[model samples]
Target chain A: MTEPKVKDNDVVVPGEELASGMGYLPGQGTYRDGDKIRANRLGLVHIDGRAIKLVPLAGRYLPKSGDVIIGKVRDVTYSGWIIDTNSAYRAMLSLKDATNAYIRKGADLTKFYSFGDYVVVKIFNVTSQNLIDLSMKGPGLRKLEQGRVITVDPSKVPRIIGKEGSMVSMIKTQTNCRITVGQNGVIWISGEPKNEIMAEGVIRKIEREAHVPGLTDKIKKELEKTNKGEQ
Target chain B: MTYSKRLDGRGFEDIREMEAKVGVVKNADGSAMFRMGKTIAYAAVYGPKDLYPKFLQDPERGILRVNYNMMPFSGMGDRVRPGPSRRSREIGMVSKNALLPVINLTDFKNAVVDVFIELPQTDAGTRCAGICAASLALADAGITMRDLVASVSIGKIGDKLVVDLTYDEEAIKDMDVADIPVAVIPSTGEISLLQMDGIISKEEITEAIEMAKRACVKINKVQVDALKKKFEVKKNE
Candidate 1:
């Protein structure tokens, strides 16, 4: 049987003892003491391998090509409705991409999108000048309903979702929170009090120590412990 | 002199308690921090990152961008904004010019190098101080360059040329005659950057240039001493 080694961030080299029963390779270094613990690539340790890599499952809000993000309408102009994509650059929902009907040259565009409404739209393109073009004519893309929104670092969205939706599915089963993780680092969590609290705690914990190893197991243990206590 | 002013028991031409330190920002590609009397500046260097978009890439030398920012508390009063304002833009240009001669940008093709200057306190002659700080930062970042650049500001007050000006002296003093600002590579005695703002005669400018050059040579020694101290401290650490 292979030994499970702990992975840590400070280890500059691979095969170093990260924690108890855990070792880290510099890059996607791996060992399978009992289970397959292999690294796929090298990056800053987001979470220690011994623990569950609890990626905060929130909808990614980063402006990317083909991502349908929910943005707040900030301004209305003759050409388009400016939407705040929660990025350094604002996304413009042009009248042309917004609807099939022609937006008059001098009509009140605010009627289409009020200041506070959350509109779901796909990013068609992002110019080098930081101009973002948004299109709303897509499936599962429209105005967002009432739900609290949260944000995380855009880089960590993939981890929150886990490989093939494993991590997020676990959270959904455990907490019953109807959560959505955006590519732009935004998360929408809506559910019962107990479920919302559990999800929020899990997400917050992930944000604080995503660089540590063995995050997945740690999160699982905590959640299981909480569940058992409730029973 | 019409207005007799004394600083630290020295005449008008004297410089204040000046010191330089290198390798201050460990994470930066290169870094140097300095305190000229009350003035303090930290400089960091990054890149030869590839110039974005092939069109912006230079065929010959790399593009150099110098950013100078004064911390809100860099002054005696309120804290400042992070981004560059008008004053910082002017200083940034001067700093870039100061380091130009020492850097052989042509060596790094299609690249862009950046220098960031953070001034925690502003006395006088920050431009020159920034130039000197940036050169050391560049060296620490391990960027290949011809030599270290040193800068000194020579301001005239009541017919005497001061090596480094203090805040009060710079503001109240009538610099009707232009002051000489020069950055030099002391090793080869090559001029990197030069500017004069007020209206001084050609003869006065020439004399001020000579005076500024001499001050920079002295300042360069301080830069070397600071680097040696840094290495000694690092060895112990």
Candidate 2:
């Protein structure tokens, strides 16, 4: 029989022993040395059947295919734009993938996507070496305008979005604001100044308390309190 | 006369009081503060991001760069020069090697992870404290590390062996003092760093290393707790 040292959902540090036996298998963020499984990162330990996994508490964003991300045009290339995906790797948005319409070879691409402009786009392909290709033809993929952007820890994005987008939807309807959350942790809010501030505040709150239990309820209550305060 | 009593009246194996806190630097990816005796070390971890000056990029894996600095007025001696000095550069090099073994940077090829360790105040064992703080910050930043590195200064002051030595202990006049700063990987009892000054007999040095190993285990406990406390605070609140 395997000996499990930590229970599920327990916070573990690097090199901390999670279990001591071959009955359990090591998963992400964990490795087996001899008969002991040790944590390789600072995160929550999860024991699932025969394998143990980890959920990181904080980390930099690593781009993956089919993820909706917010990027800034760092350099306008000859045939595409170099986008900083707020990650270690930069992404390329070729002219063909930039839009549906055809354009001349020497045409100015800045008119479509200029430098220092933030856009919400979908990553279409990612090479093993982390060369990312982006596409702007999908829905809600467009340049962000005048509203402010806030970046939080990429690891907390899922908590801010909630299950099936319920948390975000509630915030949208309650604050009466339009918000787009990028997988890269960059979020855009567009609405009246006061309401937009409230939306941003609520999102920030979620990011801070992402590790705590019953977060969805606490956030809903917070939004209600703020809404009542305005009236 | 044999050095029977510590100046601060602590036991031979006892270390100074330690305090550790994580996530103190809000803007940094990961940050921490560690205190030992009167010394304080604040470390911030940034990156695994793009490394510029293309010549330095490594295709195999990312590089770890550590910069250990002491504020001009924070030194135990005279005001330290504001920038990198011969002493600080050596400490920085060892600190990088101290932490490099545990981190896996293969996923971040051509990138860099920079650790900046700043000391606001110090009594002794400042580099060791800085290494301890750097370990906590790396964990707080969620970097993939095989283990945490815990460090301390184990010394032989006169005829007595000690776990951690203060400036007064190091400055004792006409005493046969050996200040040995050691960094150990707690899990494996592996020494990542070892440096010494003054004199120590072969048998005594071996014994001091054994003591450092145990002291490291204690320090590692504090580092682990600092990382967990970052999460526990949220639950309590």
Candidate 3:
């Protein structure tokens, strides 16, 4: 077995050799050339047993099925609504998957979700041709009310949400704000003016320091400080 | 008329004082500024976003567009017009071709990636520097690429072959030589872009290509270093 040349968290550039031998399968962000596995992007390298992959540091969001995303209604067609999911590929929200209500033909679709309204939707399907289909019938998926939206690095979404929902829940409890984080890097916060600002600050900090070790602890400390200030 | 041999008092094989910085344009998705001797160039990348004009959208792969431009006062002579002249258009086309193969366009199907290269100071090798900066910018954007493209120009002066020609060296109308600018993907040893001017024999072309390849290896190292520095972790103060 050939050992991987780079360990986890080690930064790698495109075309850098990861491993050269049999038994080492090329994974995401890596390509195979003969017996050598080489990186095809700039990012941190991860070696899992016999598989090697790279997680890119920065990139636009690529829509995937089952991902909960925040989308803006760009246009409303007769059959569906064209949604911008903060990705290169736009998503379609058919009237069937959009809501459970029955609607007559030529009825005003804009009455349901007007142009520029943000909707929390889940990607139901992403075709090989990059066509995206979204669903609004899922739980916690609906139109966003009055709130401020901020964008972050899409790759940092996992960090912002934390392991499970601990970090986001902690922020919500401390700031008394309702927050919804989209997997596409858009965060919606709604609460009292003061609490909303506080939540925004905490979320921005997470986005900025997402790559740092022990980030959860750091965020916890910061939240504690803010809580004390409120009292 | 022997005049200081060449500008900057460097040997034929020596490149100019080169430096690069990534993320120079904060608002851009990715950006890089590169300097080769006195020539300065900046490149910014936007998208993999939606392609407008519905007609131009390709169902198979993303389209890569490069716009190469120069500031009105960048040249040594009178101010150049601030628009897409014939020269800029040609350079943009070649630059786009140079970068097309390295990027994984299929990853962002039905999208477009725009690269804008702007030269604020003109010299002999602006296009080469632009390619270098654009490559860095693309990598900074985290676009999946097979390899970084490194570019340099080799010019034959009198009886010697020189790397990275200066403005004065390029303007010599009486010299019997060739000025060859080449961009290469060093890892794969693939020539992505190549342009030549003046007269040269086949043997010289081969020799020049080999020399450019060696120089590209060095340039690729610099590009990697700059990227590493940009993403380097800093300890808490």
Candidate 4:
């Protein structure tokens, strides 16, 4: 059998040949071109069994169904609210899925969610043309209030959240802040003035060093150091 | 008068001293700066965001829009106009076509990806430099691309053939000078962009393209290095 040209976690650019054998299946950011696997984007190589894929390092947030996101209400239409999910496509949060309350149509829809308000929403449906359908009727999905909102690289969201929320939970316990990380990279933090600022700094640090080795250990140490300073 | 030696005291196929850097603009989705000889080009990639004109939006794939601008004082000659001109407009369109073959924008439907190339200093080969920089920025932005496009100017100076032309060589009054800006996909040897000014023999055109393809192979190495260096920084440092 022919060997793979690239190993796991190798930095690869577009058009670089990964492997030229039929034994490999092409995954995201990679394609099979006449029995040769080639990368179609700049990312790290990930070999999963018979499939080879790439983990992107940068790009705009791509909206996906069943993803919780933080969005800003750009326009309040007659039937629903138009939300900007920090993506190329806008999401429509209809009145029926917006809230459990039953209200009459054409009677001040902005009363529920007005313009420029930030809300936590869950995308329920996405069309082939990229039309997004949002629903606010989920656990912990509501309009954010009095919290500072910031954005990070969506590609690093999984790292910031850590493996099964371990990384974020550690930060929350140490900083005593409530942090909501959106799959789209929008984050909301609310807590005491001093702790909230600390939480934001930690999150930004994670974003910067997401690709660094021993990232979890480094973040844990940094959080403890800040906690000692506060004592 | 016969021309035997190059005006810059360099070999015919030699490209000038070059340097490239990526992620120069902090706020842009992806950005880069490329400098060759006296010419310098900066390119920034933005969007895949909402397309402004509703009619221009395509349901199948995103569109690429390139804006090429030469700063007013970039050239040694008279000041260039700040806004878009006929020359810049034509270059922008050609540059867009130059990059379209390599970039895959199918993931972003009904959106637009904008690449802005600004040159603060230039001697010659300005559009070619801009194309090289834009290709690097697009790849750095993590746009799905089949390959990176590298560009250089192949000049036919009098009876001599040159890989990259300097301003002095183009301005030589006594002999015929032909400037050909060509962009190539290094992996495939496909010429995505070709533009010519002045005159050259039919047989010499093939030779010029081959020379450019070689120079572009060397230039592609620099582009690849600039991107890798961004992520290579150690976290402890």
lDDT of 1 at B186: 72
The superposed Cα distance between candidate 2 and the true structure at residue A39, in angstroms, equals: 1.0
Docking class of 4: medium
State residue A58's C-alpha deviation in candidate 1, in Å: 41
User: What is the TM-score of each predicted model, taking all chains together?
Assistant: 0.49, 0.97, 0.96, 0.97
Candidate 1 docking band: incorrect
lDDT of 1 by residue, B1-237 (tens): 544564545665556678888767755656789878888889988765556777987766678899998887777675677677898999899888877766657545566788999888987778888887887777555454545678887776666666776667656544343456788777556777777766666777778778777777778777767654543442232
Candidate 2 has a TM-score of 0.97
Mark the regions of model 4 whose C-alpha exceeds 4 Å error after superposition.
B235-237
By lDDT, the candidates rank as: 2, 4, 3, 1
- Model 1 spans with C-alpha error above 4 angstroms: A1-231, B1-4, B78-82, B173-178, B234-237
lDDT of each: 0.66, 0.91, 0.88, 0.91
Error of 1 at A4 (Å): 57
lDDT, candidate 3, equals 0.88
Put down candidate 1 lDDT per residue, A1-231, tens digits, no spaces.
233343323211111122333343222222332323332111223344434221211111335688767677898877888887765457888887888887667888777788877777789997644458999897867776666777765656666777687777778777878877766667777788678878977887776455545666677788888988999
Summarize candidate 3's per-residue lDDT along B135-206 as a digit string, tens digits: 999988889998889999999876677899999888776656568999999888899888998878888889
